[model samples]
Target: MKANLIRLGVDIGGTFTDVVLEKNGSSFSTKVLTTYAAPENAIIQGMHQVCAKAEIEPGAIDQIIHGTTLATNALIERRGAKTALITTEGFRDVIEMRTESRFEQYDLNLNLPEPLLPRQMRFTVKGRVDANGNVLVEIDKSEVETVVDQIAEAGFESVAVGLIHSYLNPAHEQLVRDVLAKKLPDVNVSISSEVSPQMREYERFNTVVANAYIKPLMASYLGRLEDRLCEEGVRCRIFLMHSGGGIISIQNAADFPVRLVESGPAGGAVFAAHIAARHKLDKVLSFDMGGTTAKICLIKNQTPKTSRVFEVARTYRFKKGSGMPISIPVIDMVEIGAGGGSLAYVDTMRQIRVGPESAGSEPGPACYGRGGERPGVTDADLVLGKLDPKNFAGGSITLHGEKSKSALMAHVGQALEMDPVEAAFGVAEVVDENMANAARVHAVENGEDLSEYSMIAFGGAAPLHAGRLCEKLGIERLLVPPGAGVGSAIGFLRAPFSFEANRSVYMKLSDFDSQKVKTLLCDLKREAAGFVRTCDEFSEILSEFKVYMRYSGQGWEIPVELTEEQAMNPDAVAFQVRFEDDYTKLFGRPVAGMDVEITVWSVNATTPSEKVEPVAATDGADTLVVNGARQLYDPATAKFVDAQVVPRDEMEEGQRTAGPAVITEEETTIIVPASRNAIRQPDGCIDVVTKE
Candidate 1:
């Protein structure tokens, strides 16, 4: 980014729409309640607010980067456009009949989610393409035209073409698309080969269906946003953050909105990775808790881990396989329905249970006084003295403590036969424990230890509970960076312009063909780099190569990275050695006799990463910062303690404060538990470490 160029980063979350404006190494940020009906309204409002703070006109903005949750929300709510799917005759049930394995093994009355398109909506054509890219059965033009006529008569807003083995050979799918375009020119179309060019009929078909489903919704929103921004005199090239922790041109984002499903969380991960680089931390845990959900990601060596697949809208208690799987490059993380607005209730087992449901910003938490009666995490925090009733959102939205107390008592206290404070404690503990368990599971899955990783907490609600969470996870240190509440928006600015191109070609190490491998890799590089060029025509682009490999009998594969040299000159022996090294690190050892096979190959082309200046730890003498004290609840001691209230802006460098304190800022507040102490670092980061 140019020092003098003004950049705007916007993140539309489930609850809040965050905006950040940056120029000449300075930034201004604001948080506004998300406008569900017109999410762009919030963005415009927040943009003006930040521009006012920065003392600049909206027209002065040089660029805009954005990420939104509309795609994920549309799929989760099942409220996308009326979509129809066309597939090979026999594979019509591929989406309906998901993988055989049940997410929960012992539940006898388990129920799988229904397919996105019902049987009536999913039409089949007589077409077949084998796994070897052979055209076994070609579709008759009249038959495709017949199917298209029915789709047009049914008034589908979007149509998805997903034939069997479309990833291997897209001719049939493309033919279907051509027929649809001729019949229904106005209707949107998405093909599996373009949305997700990979194997697995179920995943590929579902991915295309999802893209088509959300196509109209996202396209309309982006178009409206651009028009409105231009109308407001904001003349800037708009970019979008993709789920792979990078930026892409708006044109690319509009074509494949599924890539934006995890965009907001991906930006948060990028923000944490930037922090990790500045501090030179090898291992860091990124925790982001907003109003509707909480996300946890592991950052190692200043980069967030990447994955080719992840689930969205998990239907059963955030179970891995219970949600729609969209096969696209993304930052790997575990997100659960545990956030500020996550509602709470007493379960049938006489235990307090937190959310997979949220109150959202329309009604918000009970304390928001917007007609919501249920007690959520925000209500519990208010009852527990973790959030100030009068100072929330910089006093823009005043909270009602009595409303929270009443709601908590009615929903949880009476059922549990406990007081409001006790009920609030139960809810808070459950929320914290749920997030900790998720973090632990994610860490164990990746062969990591929580105790060895430092925590970087952000988002509007994370810092309030991060202290207690660190205690539970046995983490010793936490860093709350500036602009923590709007971390994702800031991350959007930090991300590079990039794209990942993926293809599935079944091959075994025993049949090593260097020439074929070289061609495939080169083609992938060109495809991925071409997308990046659309974002920045002149910036130097770097290519990253990876292969997903598994043993012959295994159902899944792990990603193994390869250098350009290694990819260009493929060797069977070298492939085995690299696969085994990564495999041994993950599973302790690799099988000696099993043959190794590659399922998917990927190439990511990205702009060169920005250089980072290491943060010099503040070594000046520590001075305690305390202006007043309030009765803040101490979860560890199960009692109320007089905690100091320190204004963050007034705190000087090297200033230190013991636990039982609250560091107050405009966008958020950091709660320092009694068991730990905090110090203001040279870079304006609040470092929270355990008391000696």
Candidate 2:
């Protein structure tokens, strides 16, 4: 690919649709209010504006990489198509009976998240495959035909097939897929063996049901988007970002939308990982605050940490194990509904609370003047003088500060008997505290310490809150990288074309079958390589092998790395050594004499990533003076202080600006308190270091 080949990346968020165009090593980005009815409208409108600014034709675009929250939003909002779940006879209620644990033990009135497929829609067939992949009970072909007829009569849009132990032997699943195509050619079908070929029936079944539940909707939307782009003279290939911080073909995405659930956050992690590599920061915490959510991810050694299973739409205020569990490779991060467009109001106990609820871009925060009466985090930001009235979103939409103030006053201020400014601070503090609490809990749960990690801030609203968040978390430094406004969109350009193939087959290290393992790994590698070959132009592909291992009695498994040579040879000692190494890194030690068994084997075939170098420092301790000063409330001091204001672009690398100061940019502003001193890094990042 030539440097002049225009590469466009579009990310659809809850509040804004971000577009980034890269050409000849330079990038141009813009944000527009997302169009809820037709998301492609926002993409076209934003693409037009950015292309006009760059003076390029749409036909010149060589590739378009996209990431979106639409699939996730639909799953969370319960707006996907009516779906049916078909499983083994005894596992009809697996999704509903999640984990058998209470997220909030003391809260007696807690409501559980509803299953995506209701009990009435969940049907089962008489099929059995033993744990060793032996066919104990054969599937009745006539029964499958009868089930298909019943599904057609029931007016279902999609179907999920999840037989017990199907991950080990997909013969029954493949038969169902073949029958599905012959019976109902248009309806989409997803199988657990294909969607999530891992053990644990609950997670695997839920993942397949989720895929089937959202298949029709995602397929229709993606088809329409592709058609619309073709109509707009864009002949480039479209790549979709996956939950694992990589790019895969559109066909793969459509076939398995479960892998796309965390795609948006994965992009943010990729963005932060790139910045960390450029700045040579070994420990970094990526903070991304969009319109509807805030995400916190940890990066080390220039790579984001990845997890095999994560929950979605937690019920008890984002509590773990209280939501739908999906088994797929995803970048590990903590996400909360604390963003600019998150709703703010008085709760049932007469306490002020911010979302979990969001007034999205359609009828955005009251400050946007888009027919919304609910006060939001953005409204409070405007009320507190953090946002520029005229230059918001580059002046795309004029903000009404008074309207925001009035809405906040009527909804929050009068109830608390405080003035609008104090109330505004309250809203901001609550949201900030919510984010801090989430980050703290996530770090502690993962056995990580945040004090030692630097912060990488992005998204439209992250920079505004990053400085303050660091102050609260006792974090010493922060990096607000270039293209901060649309960081995730730009990150799409850096993703690699890859796919991971996983399968479940219980085999103890003591009973290791080298021949069987070699054959299984070879088949999975070919399957994964076939997917990557569709989107990459490479002569060779690299393979990564891993196994999910755990003690015999343990309920869950931990992933451990396996070498190509080791995967072909049977050696219990080597397996134990690798498992112990990984276990010690995570939990500080491994239990002795515990028999470890491999539950799932995963192989990822990938194309190589482009080389990225660290940005060099331009050394000089220059002082950038403020244009003016303003009285702003500082939470650490718990009082109002005079803060200096400086434009972010005007301050060059190596410039020092002391707090209390406000660093303003086109997309967001950074507020530094008197307790912190900011030094501009060589890579144009503001490293806000603590002062003694």
Candidate 3:
């Protein structure tokens, strides 16, 4: 919140660790290979590199805001600590018996994903809390103790306790935690009431289990990161980026690591929103393609769309209802396994299929010369001349073009009976089409048209492919902002301190009690504000209210936002009006003569967003800046074209360049497709637009 203070933003992705150091209003950044054995090692390496670039020591950093994909990775890889779950006696299989929804409805061989915890690992307690917070059956302390003893005998490092209806009456769940604390004090415990106080036993139980599964791993990493920073003479307070596009205290993040599952992509969304606000664009598509995954989100009114629940580790082609559902406040986006390091090979249909499998930094893309045999998206980019073999990562790492050619030939070309160049083209097009299709589907799901939206592309690999993606999606304008390669890390510095608290208390409008509604909202506000206060005690906090409402007999609900006055002054008529307005927008029209019901209430408390200086639009003189030329593969034409190569720093404000050009920066490169032109906007953003 103070000017001239040095701050550090670190994001650890599956393949790369990005660090940005901001000092005296200027920033320096660097990317390093992620160390899986010791993730913090990468952070330290990246931090030092940025510090050296800024001509400062690590000790000069006043604060650090970090986000990571480790938690999501743990859940995906199922390499977390050995964890057990305790639940109501009858609901032991809630997680395994997921709601009746099939991602693949007609595929009889649809292989359902295995639950996080096996039935043997999930022990049940004899306790019952009714829907109205009434105790139908008091929890037996002895039964919980017996379960705890079994858990200890089974050598579980962590425990999850999720009693039915615990969101209404957490007293039963607390007793189990108290018993665990007295017996297995070292074993970490996660309870549904504290982790996610929402309805639906399946999502609630799964969430707590996920939190418990990764709690120890995250806590250990955070502890080691703090110690390593302290060992380096850095005394700055540390914070963590959360999935809801906000910053939280490190302690809270460690306590509830599930909230950090989408943290990195969340930061990117925030960054895109910030850019959208500065450019005065209400409808923008956020495209973030990193080393391991690509995330696409839609921003309206400079705010990233938010969701209360999202799936993680979708086992069946990134389909809905195919992965473990995580119930937390998150930036809603569609993330697919398409990134620079995503591997490619010919499928059974003789089509190239790119990742959900990435050759991470250990043995990165084939072009990295890191012992990887399979060609990846990066390898394709290298073979296609989108990357410089000599100057990759600003010459920090040399790329081997021959290796890329060989891998592409062996993996894809040979199978498809094509040359290496054609194979590379196939791989690139497949990956780009995958991303484009994902963006289109996401937009359609939200009732939006891609043609009406501008694109904000970021992340390490996005700019290189964004132009072609724009072409495919029929998007007219694209903005590749400054520090685009490390946009998420930069976003950490721009986010506000905030937290969202959610509770599910089903109440039909016919039975709505205004006094009770006010009380419920107030309590949630306090709970969310308390978490934000732990991050920053001095900043003035603001509150946002939302409720999920649906007509009676509907399977799902739509989120309806409410102002402070409308929220505080509970009116059933007003609530119905708002709900119908949002429903009509989402669906074609609202059903008439149906009673509306509120399912979940959410309150987000956040500090004010940082003020931004707007950037004036720039129109360059009708001249091109052609510093040099190189052979670039044009995807639109499916052939090689001589393209201009211009260094980013040399492009002055309002300057322009024609299609088939490479606007190169130290961290990344922007490829202007044959159908587009590039403009250096006044704010250092390369604005790419359609030539027509």
Give the alpha-carbon lDDT of every model: 0.92, 0.87, 0.93
Q: Give the per-residue lDDT digits (tens) of candidate 3, residues 72-124.
A: 99999999999999999899888988996889999999888999999999988
Lowest lDDT 10-mer window, candidate 2?
617-626
Q: Highest lDDT, which number?
A: 3
Full candidate order by TM-score, most accurate first: 3, 1, 2
Write down the TM-score for model 3: 0.99
Task: Estimate candidate 1's alpha-carbon lDDT, on a 0 to 1 scale.
Answer: 0.92
* Clash list (residue pairs), candidate 3: none
Model 1 residue runs over 4 Å out of place are none
Q: Which stretch of 10 consecutive residues in model 1 shows the poorest summed lDDT?
A: 618-627
TM-score of each: 0.99, 0.97, 0.99
Candidate 2, 187-285: lDDT as tens digits: 889999889988888899999998998888889888998999999999888889999888898988899988889888898899999998888889898
The stretch of ten residues in a row with the least summed lDDT in candidate 3 is 618-627
